[model samples]
Target: MGKITGFLDYPRLGETSEAPAQRRKHWREFIRHLGDADASTQAARCMDCGIPFCHNGCPVNNLIPDFNELVHQQDWRRALEVLHSTNNFPEFTGRICPAPCESACTLNINSEAVGIKSIEHKIIDKGWEEGWVTAQPAARPSGKSVAVVGSGPAGLAAAQQLARAGHAVTVFEKSDRIGGLLRYGIPDFKLDKMLIDRRVEQLRGEGVQFRTGVFVGDAGAGSAYDKVETIAPEQLKQDFDAVVIAGGAETPRDLPVPGRELNGVHFAMDFLPQQNKVVAGDRLDRQILATAKNVVVIGGGDTGSDCVGTSNRHGAASVTQFELLPQPPLQENKPLVWPYWPIRLRTSSSHEEGCQRDWAVATKCFNDDGAGNVCSLTAVRLEWKDGRMAEIAGSEFEVPAGLVLLAMGFVSPLQHVLDAFGVEKDARGNARAGTDDYRTSVDRVFAAGDMRRGQSLVVWAIREGRQCARAVDEYLMGGSLLPR
Candidate 1:
């Protein structure tokens, strides 16, 4: 809307990353943000489309056209305000989101979509550089208390919103630090840990209390990432007026095949968090290292791609990724799937670095070396017909795999946590709660994020958290002024 003819004059310009050879040497963010002029030009490409489907495309419903116009006008202050109005953490989404908003752009029908994500990235980065980001503390206290369980995007979002609304908010994290998946599940190469630390500082300034290494459940010992300081589930109910369960889906889907007990096979969650800890200057007695070993990452998803990138950084001899489903088309059929998420092949930066990617391949079993160490993987090709999958005859093969990382994705939240709260569960085993109210069967308990919706993107988690906060506020008070 800033420039009527800008779309015709400018082509989409994306952020550039350092060469794989150079970037893999360190665990830092390598993607460079666009310059001011370039970012303005990209923002100017936003058309005055009668309806902005991109707003709906974004899970958080970001005001895309408004921010684009502000960036094009070089009003960085206003741009940041507009971004923060909807998203609590644009820096996170701008860096990692799949950008469904661009896929739903009207210009995408016949031309390249406007670089909305890049513009967002530029705005947020500029905000931090100009010292525009600061803590927003409430002027008055509401005299109510809320306990937010877990500190992922959802929990963090809800805590910030609730705190701003003048309620006393305390976030409990099972891990040693805040940010559940963002802190541990994601690889450091894509997202630096300092970003999370920056936000944590701001959140503390906003009057949100963070209780780390405090497991609020059936009070038990913690895992390798966090040592346990137990808090009974009933204690939270007695202390806080309301409790929001934002603990994400952590029950990983397992591949129970032969040699699963081998020494080298591990869940992606177990493998990824260790590397993050090491990067943060923590020493581990027994760390899973991919160095000089043939690594096989099973499952074609973001987690699997992360495994490939981390393995490459570890100087693995080779990295191979396996996908159970058939490959999708390189390009989407926009005519048929316009204004919605499309089925298309996505090549992550990790895949481009160096990886052998195969689709429609299913692992049958893990083969072990003589000492009960995983040495190879047996797999078979599959054929899909009429929505049914069948293995092809004579397609069995084995590949060298000194280390195997299972990244098939999470199945549900840990049942013990749900049982501790005594909350009802959905058919998928997610915490039973509706988005309309986010209220669980228990009167004062609520659920959001992956705990309520199952596995999803970071953006969706943030959206759920924000909405859940509003629901809690409305229930606590008569109504809330917070945006939905």
Candidate 2:
């Protein structure tokens, strides 16, 4: 440990951010990473705990204490190396991932956990600024080929690893550009798209080929990529030695209620991607805008919070969010759930930007105006008993809403893509494959990330991708030196 009693001496320091009122005027990242001195101080707060529960909390199993010590010792280069050893893109996780590792910190039982995520953000940013983050191309070619479907975090991670293992990797994306969801699903204010472009360039330098606007499935698959060129699954099997399906779960859960067909009612995916595309300099003829409209976002997860943030930037008249479940406690029972993620109320930057949030409420139906646009919605308060919800008697109310966005999260990957590959599906409609080999029922095909595990965090997707890459390398070469 760099400082034995640093945890007792220093309080946790968080990243500074622009005020909500000021930041709401533009679609750009408002949060600033910690300075070097502040980061070192924060890193010094890592207690020399015998067992680092943060390893169990972090999906990618990052070397938390090691990196923290390196940072505290002012060894920036070594800290970056330790970080990149496990996480392919710390920038993404640093910006978007909910720090479960902090929750599991031993010090968090009574005091604030170490600022692990902020330190990571500082390390990666410094690495990029110093030009230390560069391509690590393989020493020699292995004379093998792999085809990766989708260009999200999972697929990109898998492709980078396989490429570094001396294999030819080609990533296929249905969208016109790389980064499936990271380029479209997420808003620019949270994560700058330039980070994705930088990583793509590094992957290219490593001999990884990226084929955008190409769908590796049947032409009439359920995806909305109408103009993409479709490649048959047989063609990939015949051309490439192995295939990795790391596409994200794109099938959004729907709210099947009255007036679902209204003009202003939309799924969060439908509304979010348009704004992202616009931010990327793509002009759309019909963009979904929350400008001057009373926006109602249904769902209580990250996606819903994103909607609230975007609406605020759009100058929305009013923003309201609804959660079907009861509100969690303001603070968790630390004694009962220490060293593990706990259920507690979380207020995101989007929530702080200004949103009226309600819990234990369920939308009964979307109300329609004279035209086909949604004007309001009817909802009822709920009472929970025995883990079941029942509507309260005569507690129905109407809320004015010109725009309704359903951000209830995704259920599974598009079934048509799985059908095209002839891969079996689990009860949850995720691709049926075990993590041991990441091998699908279909020979020479493997599944990873959200395609196999359903909806999860970005860190989990990176972990699955790295593991799947090792599995594919072993399957092709009969053995692999890549990390599991």
Best by lDDT: 2
Please give, for residues 1-484, the per-residue lDDT of candidate 1 as tens digits. 7799888999999998899889888889899999999999999999999899999999999999999999999999999999999999999999999999999999999899999988999999999999999999999999999999999999999999999999999999988989999999899888888888999899899999999998887654555433578787789999999999998889999999988999999999999999999999999999999999999999999999999999999999999999999999999999999989999999999998899999999899999789999999999999987889999999999999999999999999987889889999999899999999999999899999999999999999999999999999998998999898
Model 2, 1-484: lDDT tens per residue? 9799999999998999999999999999999999989999999999999999998899999999999999999899999999999999999999999999999999999999999999999999999999999999999999999999999999999999999999999999999889988988889999999999999999999999999989887757354775678899999999999999999999999989888889999999999999999988998999999999999999999999999999999999999999999999999999999988999999999999999999999999998898888999999999987879999999999999999999999999988889999999999999999999999999999999999999988889999999999999999999999997
Q: Candidate 2 lDDT (Cα, whole model)?
A: 0.95
Alpha-carbon deviation at 324 in model 1, angstroms: 0.4
Task: Enumerate residue pairs that collide in model 1.
Answer: none
- Taking all chains together, each candidate's TM-score versus the true structure is 0.98, 0.99
Q: Candidate 1, which ten residues in sequence have the lowest lDDT sum?
A: 218-227
